[model samples]
Target: MKKLKFTIEDKKIAELLGRQNFSTRESAIFELLKNCYDSGSKTCDIYIESNCIKIIDSGDGMNQDDIESNWMHVGKSNKGYKNEQNNRVLAGSKGVGRFALARLGNSAKVISKKEKEIAVIWETDWLTSGVKETSVDFSKGTIIEISDLRDIWRWKNVETLITFISRAYKGGDMKIHVHFEGETYNIYPIFEGIKMGENYVSKITMRYDSGKMRLSVTIESDEFRSEVKEIIKPISERYYEDVFDMINEIKKDEVEEPEQYLKELGDFSAELYFYLGRIGIGKEKFMYKHNEINKLDTGVILYRNAFSISSLDGKKDWLDIASRARLSPAAATHRTGNWRVRQNQLFGFVMIDKNKNPMLKDLANRQGLEEDEYYQLFKNIIGFGLSRFERYRQSIIKKIDDKNKIKNKQKENNKNLKHFLNKPTTVTKMSEKELVSLVDEIKDIQREAKEQSQAREESTKQHKYDVRILNVLATQGLRASAIAHELHNKRNSLESGYKNIIEALEEYGFWEELNSDEFTRVAYKNVPQTLERLEEINIKLIAFLDVILNKIEKNKFSQKIKSIKNSLEKIVETWSQQYTWLNFKLNIKNDKIGEFRITNDVLEVIFDNLILNSIQHNELKDKLIIKISVEINGNTINVEYGDNGIGLSKKYVKEPKRILEVHETSRDDGHGLGMWIVNNTLHMYEGEVVEIDGNQGFNMNFNLKG
Candidate 1:
């Protein structure tokens, strides 16, 4: 035999040949899969036993010369020029995938046969077992059985793995069978809406501040139909592109304030994309995108190599990664390999070298890509894709309009047909209440749609009755709380109030004694009185509702002040009961004070949080004097709420942010959300929350706008 030089050292060869350092064993497996993919395998079988991970592919089997020369070559090309399949250019071409088998297993065995009488057998231990190269003849296809698995990252739920893989590959024509812990999970494909036309794929729609744009793109597809959906699919594709373009164009437009549009677009589109895609992506055909995808029910999955990497970003605008809005390649893709990689961060990227080697970097640390260039590129590409879609959408709309004009004769027929097709059968007829509820739901849906479309006609959507209340308060300069109190007092005096309504029903011959005219008069007059009573009840109900809903609008100042008063009262009462050793009293400056137009919930939370802090944490034993006072000056409401308790640490006083953030509430003690809410609310109103300096006791000074 000719002398073999073997210039590469054995130790160096092992280090270079063994693919390791993957975060998970699943990733290592994906690397093995890429090896089979490069070998021109249409389908590869993965079998997982208790102690082994076996992979068998129908790709071309390698002979002894090929195995030793190419397979064992650490960084040699597996498929340099020929990697495309089904007109789709394969992403992995790196030779590093050969070492993936070793990364996932302690020992790997290969049984491959070319057109020869005998099959070839090659064995090698990943750790310290010298490369044992032998050649026997197998029947035909390559069979790779890797055993003695060390770090196989097996998923407890194979479904998770399948979902991950499906997203990674865009649900390509490949199949993934994950055999894990007694069950096998098969991953299917994910395609843009099947009902939606193929044109909708890779479209970008955006909503900025008050501007709305629909963008999409259309790739040529074989399937064509005259159905509305067929037309819609293409239109949607164009719309996706159109919307993205519109957002980009906003910056280029000569608007009076283009920056506003840019800022708003950046903020809003995150939600718009997530929700739109979520809703439009259907579950049954999760293969297709639909509206439900944005619902937060079926979370977004980032996938690589047919495995989920992280939770999908929700319907929220992200200023970061906005440039990636239109570039389809940058979006995550699926894998068919035994090894894959997954990432879950605001912005993440994985670079695969020409040799199929993967390297990852997260954009969160502000590494990789310049900021200005990043934004500009994002704007340009997304705009480009969107504008194309918009044009297509316009064309489709024109066609639909022209078709409608010619089909006037079949209008009724078409209406009937649409009704039959779109309407669903109900198990039971809806009651009037149910019908009314449905109407409310439909109205809400319409409102949400309008919001998504950037409908700016803010022509008061509140109830006329609600409007009257707002007008009365604004014009009369009467506080809502006082008005509520007045109404309650008035209702108490009237016989037709709650007390009288019950009395009337219990009265002697209440129904029969009244004539039709008298009964009608009572009913008519009672309407407003009834409404007034209801309003009184609503005042309380709305207050509670506001807390639950985080209602920022509607009687915010009064509600906030009231909540603070309530908290102070509770603190006083609690101290009186629990601490017999101490006495705490709240000194109120006035009956009605601090009319700051701030979020009621926030104000309440702030006061409650602060007061509770004083009671538990502050070293106040007896005669604790708490002052709840307010002063209004120059479009601002200055509040001085303090306690004669041990003041906060001096260090924390100087660095308020530190104290606000670091302070954790004991179970017995309330968390600092009260102070936080106060600080946050003050900040929202262009105000500040600071610990008053030169104070012996703990004093929180808050400035709020009226």
Candidate 2:
């Protein structure tokens, strides 16, 4: 064997090749693209043939001498100069990218132009040396051709490609022209909508200048919502964590222009479209990232310099601006789309021009910028977008409320039907004697139950409206204390001011003594006035307390036993008002049913409580039905109340431990102490209350003995 004699420098190529593995063609192609970018090519074309792949560019082509010295050389590079005076910033690094082209193919050739009087062509073939080690040359203009493409081609994800391209488009001066087969792809900003085969496009521009920097944005109209959202979401979520935190020094009350912060973010445009082809690197693909704005369902496609890009998607999560408010399904999608539009990918595309100038350019070709404060004007609107997510949250809550209402409504209707079905009707068109007997018995039972119920009703009603003694004491005392504090401050100021005024009067010798009217005016204007105001406030405070007391009492005991007819009427009336649909039919089977002897107050309390509960708990919108029946057996009277309120939760019955007796504070919508009170009142009347669980409605029966 030759013993493989090799030097340390020779080992460098081996190391470089070992490090650059070609697992996927995407990794290699990216390297090639980077090379093109560094070489200052406005466009780089990639073509794959049967046995070879080629890349061509319009950059500075090298001469034979330059190719041998630089292009054919490995791991060596030159720092390129930038035309800073004209605001042209070139890519500063290049040597690292050449390896990609070498790693992707078995051979390469280059034709480039070096200044005037010089143009050269160079070629390296791995097939000959079995490695990327040699080079040969010809004439000018830059062209690199490598054969045996299978040496490095891999499948590419178009979506990711577009995203990468979109980011690179930030410079704005470069445009990528891709030719796959005979079809051509143009990678650039679609500030206006990008259309293929006669699609429509609209353009709009936005500008922001705060003196420090100026930004001008042009985008498509249909995609505005999506583009705007994408731009802002990052700012609101990442850049400004507690968006309010951005104003740390300013108190909430002091925020006169809350939009100021958002405006400072600069101006950008949003363009939406129906469709567009993709660009960029597979890993670096920003299409999905940008396309996310389109998912907002705003019906707008985003564009960057005439190319269709990203959109938004997903339910109205925290990203929605109107999330806290109820939104039509369509509107929710719209909000989400708009949010995505305001993102970095979309907004970042606008700072440079078609020629890649960082200085914001206008439609008029005017070189100046708009005032920075002008951009601040839209801050609140952006805040509104942030708030949309909250609005979605609120909408969900409302949905829950609506669902409960429907459930309760169904329950009430089913109960009503069951009760009506269960009750026994008059036996016949027979003699009066039989009908009268049945009638008498029912009346007797009802009358007895009503009387017994009255006692319980009276007890609860007595203090129903009374305020909680403790709360009244605390609230009144607090107000009084405030009044005292205010009066103390006033008195000090008044006394000092009054004394000075009197001294002035005495010095002027206008009067020998201060009169009551004059003294009163000064005191009223200063010290006593505060006290008087406090007194008025205290009076109002007492009145407010009284109102609370009244409400509490009403809640505890509206009426213990209301007449069955009246209770039924009220329930019917309420339902009628709420559901203007069908008029209800309530039949109190009381002919055999007597004027049930339940406390009109207690009965009313129970009836109203249940009715209100039904109204609040159900998710339906329809008229309600209720049926009541009274029966007597020896000394006991039984009264039944049933409705179609969505059936009671079996949990409430079977799991009494879990069922809240007081529904009010239960936070389960609006069931409250009324249920507790109803149950207790029944107990007070020496009665047992039984609930019947059904597939649809709830039924309750009270058996009382007087």
Which model scores highest in TM-score?
1
lDDT of 2 by residue, 544-567 (tens): 443333333444353434344555
Displacement of the residue 51 alpha carbon in candidate 1, Å: 0.6
Query: What TM-score, over all chains together, does every model reach?
Result: 0.36, 0.32
lDDT of 2 at 559: 44
Tens digit of lDDT per residue, candidate 1, span 1-706? 8878657654455455554334345555655655555556666667777678777776666777777787777556555434464432343444455666766666788887766535677787753433343554444567777887765444653444455444444434455566667776665544333322322222233332223333333333212233545535545322222123333333332233444434333322221122223223122211233323212122233333232233322222223233333221111110100000111111211112222212221121111223343244334434344333333333444345345445543533333223334764531465666556556656655654654343222123212322443365355434544454555455434424555554575585453434435544776555444655775665554443333333234565455444445645754564455445445555544334445344444555556566666767655475666677755564676678777776665334533343343122222234334444455456557677655542467777777664
lDDT of each: 0.45, 0.42
Point out where model 1 deviates above 4 Å.
Answer: 1-20, 83-91, 127-138, 152-157, 170-174, 180-184, 192-380, 383-706
As a whole number from 0 to 100, the lDDT of residue 226 in candidate 2 is: 36
How well does model 1 score by local distance difference test?
A: 0.45
